[model samples]
Each structure stands twice: as C-alpha cells, then as structure tokens.
Target chain A: MSTVRVENIKKTYEKGQVLALDDVSFEVKSGELFGLIGPDGAGKTSLFRILTTLLVPDAGRAEVAGLDVVKDLWKIRQIVGYMPGKFSLYQDLSIEENLNFFATVFNTTVAKNYHLIEEIYVQIEPFKHRLAGKLSGGMKQKLALCCALIHEPKVLFLDEPTTGVDPVSRKEFWDMLDRLKARGITIVVSTPYMDEASRCDRIALIQKGKILELDTLEQIIARHAQNLYAVDADNRYNLMNDLRKNTEIVSAFAFGEEQHVTLPPHFQDEYLSAFLKEKGHTGIKVRKIAPTIEDTFIKLMLENQ
Target chain B: MRNLVFLLQKEFRQIFRNPTILRMILIMPIMQLIVIPLAADYEIKHISISVVDQDHSTYSSKLVNKMTASGYFQLVEYTQSYAQATKTVGDGKTDLILTIPAHFERDLIKFNKAQLHLAADAVNGVRAGLGTAYAAQMIGDFNREIREEWMLLPKFNEMPQIEITSANWYNPHFDYHLFMVPGILAILVTMVGAFLTALNIVAEKEVGTIEQINVTPLKKHEFILGKLIPFWVLGMVSITLGMIVTFVIFRFLPVGSFFTIYAFSAVYMFGVLGIGLLISTFADTQQQATLFAFFCMMVFILLGGLYTPIESMPEWAQWLTRINPPAYFIKIIRAVYIKGSAFSDLIPEFLVMIAFAVGFNALAVFNYRKRSA
Candidate 1:
C-alpha cells in the first residue's frame, strides 16, 4: 500500500507570479525510505508542507496514510510527523521540555515512546535541560527528530534534516532513519545534497519545480549514464576549456581538480591524448569513470532546460 | 482536554521565561497607576492674573484683594494701565488680564450696575476658561456683599433673594485621582492583555515554532485557548496590582464590592484578548503584530471616555466609542468604583461586555486557520 500519494500538485506565490510546484506527482510505498533530491528552491519544502497538511495546494490532491491531505487533515495530522525545513522547536524551551510537550500534544508520554527515540535521545540526553537555542546545529536536529518521532507516527516527513549538520552527525541521523525504517515506519525526506540521494531506497531528482527523474540510485545511473571520463592535467582550467571546445565531447563539467566529460561510446583515450598534445597540452591523464548521482542529476537538469 | 493543558503549560512556561513579560506584568501597573493619574489631573489652580485697577478706589483695591484671597488666582501684576497688563500677558508672564474702569465704585452706587472689562489669554482653553469664571465669580460675590452691607438685608429694595446650594456627590471633594485611578486601571489591564496576547502567536511565527504546532493533532480552539488563558490570568494580575497601588498611594478603594470589579474585568479581558488574538491572525511577524495592536489600542484609548466624557464628545466620536471595547470597560469600572453600582444596575453594560467577549473571540477563532491559504 502507498503511504503517501500526490497527484498533479500545483502551487504559486505572489498571486501566481512565482511557480513553486508545478504538476508534481509521486508516491511512497509503505515502509520505504523515499527521498526528494534537489538543490535549494527546487520546491522541496512546498511538497513537504502539502503532505504535512500545513499548506493547501493550489490544484490537485495529496493523501497521507490513505487520507486526503485537504479534507482529512486532522486525521492525517494525527498519523504523520513533520519536521519543517526551518529549526522550529521553541528556542526558550529546554530539549526535554520540547520533547515532552510534543508527546503530550499527541496524547502520549515521553516514557511510553522512549524506545522510538532512545538511540538518538541518548546522544543528546545529557544536555536535555539546556535551552534548544543553545544547542549546536547537530544536537538541535537530533532533538527535533526525537520530538517528531515521540508519537510513533506511521509516516515521518523530514525536510532537509541534515542540511547544516556536520558530516559525522549527518551519517548518524541517516543511520537512525534506517533503524526507524526497520520498524516499519515509512519515511519521506528531502535534501539539497546529492550525496544523500544514494541513502534513500528511491529518490526523485527534481529541479525548477519539476521532477527530472525518479528511480532507485543504480537504475537512475544505469539508464541515464553516458560514456563519461575524468581527465586531469597540470593546468586544470586550460584543460577544461580545451575539452569543452572538442566536438567529440558531449558534455564537460569541472568536478573538483578533474574535468568530467561524456564522449561518444568506445572513444579511445589515445585519440584525446593526441589531440591535446597538438594543442600544446602536457601531463594529461584520462580514465573511464562511473557516473555519480550528481553527474546524472546535472545531465538531466541540463536536458530539462 | 489533555492537549489544552499541555499547551497552557508550555505557554505559561514561555511567559515566565521571558524577562520582558515579567517586567511588563509587574512594573507596568505600578508605573502607570502612580504616574498617569498624578499627571493627568485636570483641576486648574494658581492661575497667574495681572489686574489693571484704573478706579483707584477702596472698592477696586478691595476687589483685587478679594481676587487674591480666593486662593485660585496669583496677583502677578497690579499695574494701573491696561496696556502694561496686556503686555505682561503677551509676554506669557500672566494668564489673565483684568481692567477695572474709572469710577467703577461710583457707577455701582449711582446706576446699580458696573462694568469691568476682563480679557483672558485664551491659548490654554481650560485654564483660561476656568480662570475667567473664577475671577467673574469673585467679582459677583463682592457685588452681593456690598449690597448687603449698604442696604442692611434688602428690606428697602423689596427684592426676594434666592439662595442656591449645590452638593458634589460620589466624590465630595471632587478628588481628581478618585476619578482617574479606575480609568487608568482599566487602561493598564487592557494594554497588558492586548499587547502580550498580540505578540504571542506572531513571535512563534517569526521563530518558526508555529509551523510545528500547526502540524500536530491539537485543535485550533485548543491552540487559541492556550494562547488566551495565560494572558487573561496576567491581565487579572495587572488589575490586582493596580488596585493595590491605588489604595497605597491614594488611600482609595472601589466603593462597590471587589466582586463586581473582578467579575466585570474577567469578561472585559476576554474581549481585549480577543482583539489581540484577532490581530495576530492578520500579521505574519512580531513587528507587524506590534504595530497593528498599537494602532488599534491608540484608537481604543483615545475615544474610551477616560479623559473626556462620552456625552461631551462629538457625535461621530461618540458613535465610534460605542464600538470600542475599552470604552465599555472604562464606563463599567467607573460606575463600580465611584457610583457603587451593583450588578443589577449595570446589567446593560454587563450584556454589552458579554457580547463583545463572544463577538471578538468568535471572529478570532473563525479567522484562525489551522491550514495555510
């Protein structure tokens, strides 16, 4: 059964001048870890708000746990947990107080749902008496997650839960989500970081208020992957410019110190080396590379434009 | 039921944690009660007078002495020429100018009438009007005294004397503070309730906490009641503090039972707090909420009939006051504090307070959308 179903969702701002979400559709299977992967301003937050019942879509329908988001909002609110993109817990409230308050609001108790948040709670439990505003970014995110999970919600929606968190804490947060999935709670999370896409069971690559691709990590790469190569030389900038001018290269982008370029299938490295030597390039090295999620996302975004 | 209790607990915790709220609740009443009533006094005294006595007779000097003796006027200038006195008033040294004409005593004895030209600087309307009335009243008393002394009880004049004695009820001494304390208390409670409740929801919006609350199963009325109850309690605390301050400083207490004051205030605060919650619904940030509440409060307090009587106001202003919630509360408080009016005597105002309480709160709840548009 689908935990969430969204169809033809449309939203706008400033009296429809700015299109926030346009003709969006998706579904999350029960107990699946689904991700909406995009950069900032990709309408990730709008979709999350629609599913959480915090916002009403301009057109189309969305359901959470088999209830209409607009009509059965109160029922949906009871069964779903939503952590907005912003750090929204009360700043003046202590960490424990914030958790207890949310539990009580959902007609539960902290002691009753302790197991659900025990792993993440133990990490930050020492400073539970500290005001939420005083906690570090990682600790704050952990507390927010605990609050969102205190009710043992059937579906959890976390919008950019690890956006500003440190890498170590980000990995720990994903680990907690994986454990929650083990317990059969469907999770729908969004992230601007493309590396996080690989962690989701399935993800939809979205850009400019439209989903470019939706599939598992391996499938998305295998279907859209091109004959990609990573090339490096002493003068990185000059190599990138020379590679972009080559007619044989399909697309070229600077990926850190190397230039990742897609060329015609079965293209020989020696042919590129010969061409670069004639152009007075030196110390050139080329190797075939598997496409990353970022590489495929960039390619799809370019094609969609 | 459980949700409301938890929400109220959180709200009260937040209120106690904020130092600004503590200061507003504890210090505002004492400051406003002691300061506003003392400064808002309207009884005029020690009006500067410059008398120009051209008659140079015993009656003229006696009249000037009598004016100084009344204790309401200060004889700043006792010049002979009217121009000199006029110049003193022009320079702002004096507030009133009196010109006694030549042969002023002879005219009263010969023609049974006398004319004294009195010119007052009408810049400060209340002071000028009251000073002129005071000076004219002293002159009239002098005329009566002279007649009685000259004619020996009016047996020869064949005139019947009608004596008028009037009494000031409620406030026999006409104490200005007695009238002002209750009105100021009404305003203080109103400000605390409206401003604090106004800021509550918008602060959550600004900090992004309201988004978390909206996603929960908590009902909308539960959320609104959570916001209203804490501020209502604080408003009552403010009124109680104001009463204590009033009694301590002015030795004044309400003439009616304390039950009436609290009963009326409990209902009135719901209306004021409703207005605050209503403002919160229209604003997106704390700054917007504060500005909007301030605008509403300025209109409410100005036309509230605290400084000016509603009957004396222009027709349009009085019409506006009819809709102002604070105006109704002020009138109710004044009646209970001064007139010792019972609950039965104030049934109409009680009904109005109930209507306001129900009306504003219903609109607030109706406007408060759990889901964003």
Candidate 2:
C-alpha cells in the first residue's frame, strides 16, 4: 500500500471565499522521497495538513499508512509526523527538554528513540542545555526534525523546512532527509526552491491551488513543452526589450545574468540571432540548454496563467 | 489518561521556566491580597463639622461638644449665626452644620420638647447618609441620658421601655477587612486561574507550539487538562497564600474547615479555567485572548457581587448572577469563612458549581477541535 494517499482533495477556507486546495490528488509510496514544488500559497501546506490528519478535505478522502485520515486520525497521528511550515518548537524549553517532551508524549522515551534521532541530535547535543529560542535557525530546524522523528513515524511530512536557513544548512538539511529516506522512511516535503525538486524521487508542481504536473525529476524536465535558449548581449535590459519585439521569439523573461527566450514553432536559433543582430545588437550568443526545474515551472506557470 | 501526566509535566516545566510568568504565578496574589483589601475598606471617617449655637446656653454647648467628641466628626468651626455655619458648609470646609436654635434649654422646661436642625452636605450620598446616622445615634443616646435623669422623679414609672442589644457575630467589630479579605481572596484565585490559563494557551498558540501539539495523538481533554491543571494548582496556591496573608494581617482564619474552602476553590477553578480555555480556543492571538479574559473578568466581578451584595442588584442581574460561577464561589467562601456555614447549607451552591464545571469544561473541550477539520 502507498504510505500516503490523497484523492481529489478540495479545501475552501473563509466560507468558500478562498479556495486553498482544488481537487488535489497525489500518492507517495513507502520509502520514497517526494517533493511538492511550488511558490508560497500554492496549497502545499493545505495538502500536507490533510495527509497528517490536522485538517479535513472539503470533498475528498485521504489515507495515511492504510488508515483513513478522518475516520482514523488518532491512529494516523501515531505513525505520521508533521513539521509545519513555521517553527513550532516550544521556545521556552531547552533543546533536550523539547526532544524529551515530544518523545514522552508519543508514549516512548528518548532512550527508546535514540538511534533514530542520534544522527540529527548529535549536531545539537553539545548545546542541549541551551534554550530552543536561543539556538540559531539551522539548529532550531534540526531540533524540530529531531522532535518530529523521535517517534520513528512511518511517514514524515516536512513543509518548507529550509526557507530561512543558510545555503549550507539547507544543503545539510536535504542530506539529512536523504539519509532518512535511505532508512526506508517515506518522506513528503514541500518547498518553493526548484533545485530541491531534483533531490526527490518524484515531484509535483502546483500553482493556484492546482497541480500543474506530477512526475519523476527526469520525466518532469523531459516533459518541458518549450525549447529554451539563453540570449546574451551587450546589455541585458536592452536585449530583453529587443527580444520582446522579435517576431520569431515566443516569450522572453530575465533569468539572471542572461535573458531566456522561447522561440515560436518551426523556428531556428540562427533566425533569432539574425533578428537580434538586425535590431542593433552585436556580439550576441544563443545557446540551446537543457531545462532546469525552474525553467519548466516558469513554462508551466505561463501555460496555466 | 497515560499521556495526561506527561503533558502536565511539560506544562509545569514551561510555567516555571519563564521568569516573568513565574513571578506572576508566585507573587501577584500575595501582593494583591496584602494591598487590595486595605484599599477596599469602607469605614467612613473624618467628616468635618461646624456648630451654630444661637442659644448661648449650657445644653447647646453640651450638644455641640457631644457631636465632636463622638470621634466620627471634626469640629472645624464654632459659629454664632446659622448663615455663617451655612457658609462654612458651602465653602466645602465642613460636612455638616449643627443649628442649635434660641430658647433651646427653656423649651424643654416649658413644652417638654426641643427642636434642632442639622444640615449635611449630601454631594457624596453614602458618606452623608452614614455621617447623619452616626450623629443621630449619638443624639438619641443624649436624649436617653436626659430622660434617665428625669425618670428618677416620683411619678415617672419609665413607661413600657424595651432595650435591645445586638451582637454582630463572626465579625463583631465589623472591620471591613474581615469581610473584604475573603472576597478578595476568591477574586484573586479566580483571576489567576482564568487569566493565566487563557494566556498560557494563547502564548503557546503565539509561539506556534500549539500546532505541534495539535498534530500529536494527544486528545482534546488531555491537552486542556494539561493546560488547566497547572493554573488550577497555582490558583489554589494563590488562595492559600492569600489566606495566609489574611490571617497574618487581619488575624482572622476561616471559622469553617479548610477542606471546604479548598474543595470549593478546586471546583470553582474548573469552571473558570474551562471558560478561559474556551476563550483561548476562540481567540487566535495572545492579545485577543487577553482582551477576552479582561472583558469576561469585568462581567464576573460586576455580577459576582464582590463589593456589593447580590440582593442589592437589579432583579434581572440577580438572575444572571445565579449562573455566574464566581458569584456562587464568592458567596460560598464568605458564608463558610465568616458564618462557618456547613456543607448542608451550601448544597445549592455546590450543585450549581458542579453543573458549571461539567458544562463549561464539556463545552470547552467540544469547541476545542484537535482536528481543526
């Protein structure tokens, strides 16, 4: 059975004025690391809340660990761990106390769950006496993960776990998740960072409370509809303006250090180069490159919009 | 049930760890117990007075001296004219004007009766009313003394006299603190339980720990009990501390059993903490929760009949106070501590508290959705 299952999960907040989730459905198999890649307010948190049994779907059903979310929420709560998008650790407690509290609340002891949390706990163990509020952001993230994982949950849901951490810590957090996945723990995490999407076994791209696509990392990139080209000229601003006026160009947007342009069907790169040159541009380079997840997301967002 | 103990442990640890909240838990009731009752004293004192003696007779001067000597009034002026005495009262220099008319001593010899006029500044009606009553009591004693001197005559057989003496039991002296301290104690306990319980939960909500707890397998009652039990214990401790202060300063202890006070306090706390938990569940932020607690506390105190008697309230409000948990508690504490009232006499109050405890806590747990679904 899949570790987590959601079917046509629809959620509307504020008496149907705001649709936080719209017929969202996906499944995560046991021992697979899945990623929900979207910007903020793309229903990622809502979807996670449903799977963890913290919220109910308006018109759908979901099951975690073979138990229905609504009918068996208590049973699901025992096996599913949720780290909300925000830092939810008790700030007044020390690092050791927070971990101990969570472990005991789960009807277990830190000694019983020590092996599961040892890898994450060691990083914060030296400052175990320090208050959770006094820890650095990376340390707080590590502490929250330790509290969530102390129960040895079958499925782990982490929402935007690395939003404010430094790049190094973000990389370390992903490595930690990778290590947990290697231990046969099913992990479903959400993030707006496109680069993190490649770290998951499968990824779902969501926007405006709807999933645009769901596939493996390689398959998502392989499914990009538009052929992308990097256009570099003497000036990026003037190049973007010139490229927008190009009849051969489909759409152009700045992509950091260069302008990425999509060409029309049955169009060649030389035609774009010739068009740019004719528009008072010189020393321009156009290179066809493989699409990153960011490029694919932008393409899908444009298509959806 | 197994998880409740662990949750309670965590709650106590968190409460004691924070210095500001810890101070509020440990010291606030003690401070208020010492200060609030002292400020709440209702004994009337220091009423300024002036005498207008037009008779220039011994009886008139004797009456003037008698009014000042009673210790409830201060003779600020001794005037010869009623107009001057009225001026003193109008100038806000005195509270009462005693007018002894001419032929005051001769009228008693001719017609066997005398008349005197006394004018009081009635701006503060309670003070004026109490001062006039005290003055009238002293003047009646003076009239009885003169009558006793006259009744010594041969044919005066003291016509059908009845003297009644009253004993104000439990608080014989009627010191306001004796009556006020227990009421304040009840209020302090109520406040500590309700305000802290609500604030503690909303603080958790503010820090986002509530979301973490909500996602756990903990039941709603477990979470609420864990939140409430600590404040309930602290509230009980505040009552104990307040009673200790009450005994130390006022030299009064509950004439009834201590068990009755603690028992009633525990039930009262259940009702109050449940209301507080309900507020925390309804409010999304600590500020909102604090304001809700404050507003409810106003209703609880005003309708609880803490400073005023419930019998004095409007008929509609008295009906509301029947359901107000604090009102039932304050009456119970006063009757038990002062009157040494037994449980049999408080059965109605106890049953009402039982209903409130069950009703409010059940409603709180019902409104408190662990699923947020």
Candidate 3:
C-alpha cells in the first residue's frame, strides 16, 4: 500500500521567483524506510513540508494515507508524526513536561504511547526533570522524537533529523528508525549525508529542487554504467591533470584517499598503467573499485550537466 | 477545551518554576501598589518660604508671623534685601517670598487697609496657583482677626445669598490608594498578558522549537490557541491576586460584584494576549518581542486612564482612549467598585472590550504562519 503519494508538486518562494521544489513527485510505500537524499537548498525541507501538510503546493496533489493533503489537513496531522530538521522542543519545560504537553495536545497520555518511545526515552529518562534547554544535543533530538511519536503517528516525516548530531548518535537514531519501520510505520526522512542513503530501503537523489534518480539503494548503485578505477601516484595533482588531458578518460575526480577515474569501455588497464609510467609518473598505482553512492550521485549530476 | 486546559497548566508550571520571571511579574505590581500612590499626590503642604522685611514695622512683622503660623508655609529664611530673597527663590531654596513694605501700624489704622507684596515662584503652575490662594486666605484671616479684636464694624455693599456646597462622590475622602490600586492591578495584568506571551512565543521561534511543533499534527489554530489560553488565564489569576492584596492590605474593595470585575478582566486579557501573540508573529527574537510588547504596553497604559482621568482628557485623546481596552476596563472596575454600578451600566465598555478581544485574536491567528511545506 502506498502511504504517501505526491504528484506534480511545485513550491516557489518570493511569489514564484525562487523555485524551492520543482515539479516534485514521488511515493512512499507502506512500512518502507524511504530517504530523500540531497544537499542543503535542494528542496528536501520544502518537499517534506508539503507532504506533512504544513505547506500548500502551488500545483499538484499529495495524499497521506489516501487523504488529500490540502482537503484533509486535520486528519493528516493526526496520522503523521513530523520531527523537523531543527530541535524545537520547549526549552523552559522539563523533559517530562515537554513530553506530557505534546501528548496532551494530541489528546493522548504519555503512558498510552510510552511503549512507542520507550527505547529512545530511556536514554534521557535519567535527566527527565532537567529543562529541555539544558540537555545535550543528542538528548534534545531524542526528546523531540518522543514528542513527535506521542500520538503514534503512522507516517513519520523526519527532515534532516541527524544533521548536527555526533556520529554515534546519528547511527543510534537511524537504528531507532529501523525499529520503528519494523512496526509498520512508513518513514520519509531527508538528509544531506550520503552515507545514510545506504541505510534506507529506497532513496531519491535530489539536487537543485529536482530528483536526479529514485530507486532502491542497490538498484541506484547498480545503475552506474562506467568502468571506474582509483588511481594514486607520487604527484596526485599531476596525476589528475595527466588523466584529465587524456581524451580516452571519460571522467577523473578525486575521492578520499585516491582519485576515481572513469574510462571508455575499450580502454585497457595494462596500456593505461604503461602510459602513466612513460609520462614520468613513478610508483603509480591503479586498481578497479566499486562506485559509492556519492560517486554515483556525482556521476549522475555530471552526466545531467 | 481539553488542550487549552493542558496548555494553561503547563504555562502556570513554567511561570511558577522560573523564580526570576515570577519575581519580576509579582514584585513589580506589589511595589507599584504600595509605593506609587504615596509618590503621586496633588495636594500641597509644608511649602518653604523666605520673608524680606524691608520696613521691620509692627504690621510687617505681624504679617510674617501670620504666614509662618499657618501650617501651609514654613518660614525658612529672613532676608534683608530683595535681591537675596529673589536669589533664594530662583535657587529653589524657597518656594515663595513675602516682601513687606516699610509701613508702620499707623498706615493700617489710618488707611483702613495695607498692601502686602507676595512673590511666588510659578515654575510649577499648579503649585504656584495653590500657593497664591493660600497666601490670600492667610492675609485675609489676619485682617479679620485685627478687626474683631478692635470691635470695628465695616459696612459691606452687597453679599450674595447663593450658596455652593460641593460633595465629592465615590471616594469622598479622596484616598489615592482607592483609585490607584485598581489601576496598578490593570497595568500588572496587561504586562503579564502582553509581554509574557509575546516573549514566550518569540523565545520558541528563536530557539527553533517552533519548528518542532510546526512539523507535528498540531494545527496552526490549535497551536496558537494552546499558547494564548494559558497566558490569558495567568493574567486573570494575577489580577485576582492583586485585587485580593488590595482588599487585605490597602482595605480597598470594589462595591460591585467580583464576578463582574473578573468577567471584564478576562475579556480584556484575551485582547492583551492576542496583541502579544500578534507581536510574537512579527518578531524573530525574544528581545524584539520584549521591546515591541513594552512599547505597546506603554501606549495602552498611558491611554488607559491609569494616571489621568479619561473625562478630563482632550477630545482627540478621549477618542483614542475609546479603543484602549485598559481604559475601558479601568473605568468599569472603578465604577463597579466605587459606584456599585451594575453590568447593564457597563454594556458599552464591555462591548468594546469584546470587540478588541475578537479583533486582536483574529489578527494574531491570521498573522501566524505555518512552515512552507
């Protein structure tokens, strides 16, 4: 079953001068952990806001749990839990008070939904009496999630939930989402972190307010059609320059430890290594490697350009 | 309704928990109630005066003695020259100067009347006017005393038989506390209603917590209503507590029904909270909200007739006061308490307050924006 369906959605700011979301359309399957992968200003927040019924699209329709977003906003609010990109819990209220207040807003008790947020809540339960402002960043994120989940929303929209959190907390948060997904909650999460794309069941690579590609992680990775290699030499800058000058090389860009290069299908490694040695590139190393999500994202972006 | 109650509870808890804010809200009203009345009196007493006796005659000396004997003036200096006496008045060392000419008792006996030059500083018009009246009364009493002692009868041309008897209504004793305590309570209530709500909402926006609520299933109206109801109730609670203190310590109680006072105050509080919420919508930070709220409260209190009577204000000012919710509320509270007027008598003011409450609340909700999804 489709939990969320967005069609032909477009959002523009400053009276349509700046397009934040351009003809955005996608669907999230029920019980699936979906990811909207993009960098900052890529309309991730704009798209999330539309689907969550906090915003109205200029043209198009979106439905959460088969209800139109615009017509049934009240119903949509009851069914969907949204954790915004920023930590927005009440700072003056204690942790427990914040949780209770949100729960009361939804006409439910914390005790009723205590089981839903127990895993995340326990981490901060020791400091439950402390003001939400006084908590660490990680604790604040957990409290926000707890408040968002108090009503047992079927669809959770997390807009960059792990943006500023430490690596360990980020991992723990994704793990919590996985557990929530197991309980049949569909999660639509947006993040700029490329590494987190692999953790989602399906991912959409979006940039400049448009989706470049949308598919399962494995499928998106499998879509890379170039012969990719990592090349390292004593002079890395000269190596990149030398590779870029060769018309035979389709694309050559630096990765973390070495430079990743894409060559024509007919190019042979023996000939390339020999060609590098003859060009006074000593101690050169060339090895075939798998393309990462970021590599594929960059290649797709370049291909579109 | 349930949500509103929950929010109100949360707001009360938050306010009581923060000692600094709690003290600011409570201590200010109490101080205003206790100290402002004493500091804001119009009645004059114990004015310092300097006497310059150029003649040093029996009549001049007697006039000086008569002026000092009256409790209104305290004779602080006896100057020989007019320049020194003028300098004393100019330097604020004395409030007035009495210049007695060089005339013997023979002038008063022969001429049947003597002229005394009284110089008064008119820097403060009201005080100077009152001082002149007091001086005339004192001199007239002195002349009458002399005539009675000598048993000399003077024929009068005409005396008006029309008598004017004035009776001060409401507060007959003119107790400033009776008038001020209610006005102070109104200011405190307005402060809490306007300032606290604005600061609370703007603080959430500044700290990014508003984004958290924005993404939730909470409707914009629900969120705004949730925030306002608590502060409105709190403002009413503060007003009630202030009234209690007014009755207990100051021994001033309203003659009308407590229910009527609270009803109008409750409606007025909604208007104030709505204004606060409106200010919060426009401000991005707590500091901006605080300044905005302060500015609005200053206008509201000044025009609300807290300091001056609305009836005495100019026509344009009176029209402006018509829209001032506090002005109407203060009038209602004072009338109901002092005049024992019924609810029907305050129908117009009540209607205006209701209009403010609805108009401001609608503006607040309209200005409140949701996230651009």
Best by DockQ: 1
Deviation in Å, model 2, residue B345 alpha carbon: 3.4
Among the numbered candidates, top TM-score falls to: 1
- For candidate 2, give the lDDT of residue A258: 86
- Candidate 2 lDDT over residue span B1-373, tens digit each: 8899888888888878878877875687678777888887677888898888889898888777887887889999987888888888789998888878889999976888998887899998877888888888878888877777778886767666788989998889877777877888888888888888888888888888888997888887788778888988888888888888788877889988898898888888888888888887788788999888889889988999888789989999999998888888888999988999887788888888889988988887888776772
- For all the candidates, what are their Cα RMSDs to the real structure? 3.3, 3.7, 5.0
Candidate 1 per-residue lDDT over residues B1-373, each given as its tens digit: 7788889999999989999999989998899888998898787889999989889999999999999988899999988999899899899999998999999999988998989988999999889999999888888898888988877854687556889998989999888988888998999989998889989888987899889998999888898889999999999999999999999999988899899999999999998898888888889988898888888878887899889888999999989999998898898898999999988899999999999999998998889886882
Q: Is the docking of candidate 2 incorrect, acceptable, medium or high quality?
A: medium
* Consecutive 10-residue window with the lowest summed lDDT within model 1 chain B: B151-160
For each candidate, what is chain B's TM-score?
A: 0.93, 0.88, 0.86
TM-score of each: 0.90, 0.88, 0.80
Q: 2 or 3, which is superior by lDDT?
A: 2
lDDT of 3 by residue, A144-257 (tens): 889888999999999999999999999999999999999899999999999999899999999988999999988988987667888999998898889889887888898876
lDDT of 3 by residue, B273-309 (tens): 9889889889999889877777887888888898877
Model 1: CA > 4 A from native: A227-254, A257-289, B49-69, B74-94, B97-123, B139-163
lDDT ranking, best first? 1, 2, 3
i-RMS for every candidate (Å) is 1.3, 1.6, 2.7
Per-residue alpha-carbon lDDT of model 2 for A1-305, expressed as tens digits?
Answer: 68888899999999999999999888889999999999999999989988888888899999888899999988988998899989999888899999989998899999998988899899999999999999999999999999999999999999999999999999999999999999999999999999999889999999989999999978988877677899899877888888887676778888888888888767878987888888888779999877788888988998899
